[model samples]
Target: MSSATVDTPEGGFEFIVHDDHHHDDGEHHHETGTMLGFWIYLMSDCLIFGILFAIYAVVGQNYAAGPAPVDLFELDKIAWATAWLLLSSITYGFSVIKMHENNKNMMMFWLLVTGIFGAAFLYLSVEEFMHLWHIGAGPGASAFLSAFWFLVGTHGVHVACGALWLVVLLVQVQIHGLTHENKRRILCLSLFWHFLDLIWIGVFSFVYLTGVLL
Candidate 1:
């Protein structure tokens, strides 16, 4: 139902109109604002990552007689982790497509696949970090290690949170079906998941590849 205000010779009155669906002005505005607010939050995240990258660029080579990237970074493992993250992004895209098609089961299935890929990426990353620590090339070893750990670890934490959020969303969708609010939440998460993929590409190229190759 929708109500509209009208003015006539009898002053002002409001009437409620019965309808199959509601399209209240306030509800539409709220949905629009949700996306706009999420975009602003993403911009803030970009700034944070930008500052981290700048810090790494400045301190990445200050090895201080410690293990360098070539000595500590195993490109084979990094490559595998990169593949997992990239695959997760692709799966997430498929999930969004299913979402738009209104196939809740397929959408949830793709989301679960994406979460698995994300977990694999995190597992590889943690194993690499453990190997580095065991070899005495941990973050405290040098300026270079510090910057590398901070930049990469921050991204890892973000991925962890995203995976957890995905799980919660799955439950919510299962309970609530594909309501408008749930759809909006899915879109917000899609942006966030894709944004993480973009940031990881920069990390792989700038931090991993550049450190090892250059």
Candidate 2:
């Protein structure tokens, strides 16, 4: 019997549909939850980011004596940065899928691409911050600057850590293929990476777009 399929927005991808209506055969259904671990990690990350965001909301607009987002942030720079990070997510997806196929070389190639894009994203973050610092908008400048630093800086730090972790995992995967533990770790890291992308959307929309307009 042929299996069912689902339509994916990524251009007609195939997926198996579970038979919820029937259960038979000596089929040993394993309840191995990879998602639970990912959720826990996401929740913990939320706590970290939540605290930072609260700090920003508290002290974000104290532009008392310094330039605000309206003054230092540029649209073009953010657009490029967003592209880099978003593209990295796609590359990371390829790496994960390739790992599943046990195509070690292809996996490594995609991972290297992921790392490069991740690096570019981090570099752009540093440049943005450096530009602000050059314009005398340090933490000591004003509440707006401080909060801006706290929010954006916090996310940048996460991305930096993620990039570093990705590089290490690349070496580990190359040396040890995708062992069960490594697979789990990679899956969790994928969740981490994608979650950061979601948060970045929030950062861009709230911190940049809204901040500039309103």
- Show model 1 residue runs off by greater than 4 Å: 1-30
Following a full C-alpha superposition, what root-mean-square deviation does model 1 have from the true structure? 7.6
List of clashing residue pairs for candidate 2: none
**Which candidate comes out best when scored by lDDT?**
1
Model 1, global lDDT: 0.85
lDDT of each: 0.85, 0.78
Number of the top candidate by TM-score? 1
What are the TM-scores, per candidate, against the unseen true structure?
A: 0.86, 0.81
Give the per-residue lDDT digits (tens) of candidate 1, residues 1-214: 2333322212112212311133454233435556788989989999999999999999999999988888777888889999999999999999989988899999999999999999999999888888888989888999999999999999999999999999999998998887666777888998999999999999999998899876
Model 2 spans with C-alpha error above 4 angstroms: 1-35
Candidate 2 per-residue lDDT, tens place, 130-160, comes to 8888878887888877778888888999999
Per-residue error for 166 in candidate 1, Å, reads 0.3
